[model samples]
Target: MKTSILRWLLDPLTSLLALWLWSRDRGRRPYDAVWRLARVTRHPDELLYRVHGHRPDDPGDALP
Candidate 1:
């Protein structure tokens, strides 16, 4: 387990190199794309309500 954790920490060298190479080109990094996507979804409650189809007045079926 210790070895796995150490590897995970050091694994960024490869990703860093990839990002550096991508910067040389005109392509964007995967991390940036994910961050942009997350920024667009800042409202969690609104998104969840749309997904679950819940209404403000509709309390749903009450359970005993």
Candidate 2:
């Protein structure tokens, strides 16, 4: 119930933000930036691991 309500409130805001980003990047498809943002937002830890090349068990991973 809580998750659903959060999604309901954020979905429209996400769409509008995506549309704004799409307008800024004219060379890319409308969905490109949104999709990338969605993927990162969905799995930020995975993105951080890939970017920093650190194992999940590393001490630095616990900073935040």
Best by lDDT: 2
Q: Residues 1-64, candidate 2, lDDT per residue (tens digit)?
A: 6743554466756555555676777638636445446445655755653333223567886787
Clashing pairs in 1: none
lDDT (Cα atoms) of all candidates against the true structure? 0.44, 0.55
Q: Name the 10 consecutive residues with the lowest summed lDDT in model 2.
A: 47-56
- Cα displacement (angstroms), candidate 1, residue 15, comes to 0.4
Tens-digit lDDT string for candidate 1 (38-57): 32354344443433322335
Off by over 4 Å in 2: 1-10, 30-64
Which residue pairs in model 2 clash with each other? Answer: none
Name the weakest run of 10 consecutive residues (lDDT summed) in model 1.
Answer: 31-40
CA RMSD of each candidate after superposition:
14.2, 10.4
Error of 2 at 51 (Å): 13
Model 1, backbone clash pairs (residues 3+ apart or across chains), number: 0
In candidate 2, position 7 carries an lDDT of 43
Work out the TM-score per prediction.
0.28, 0.36
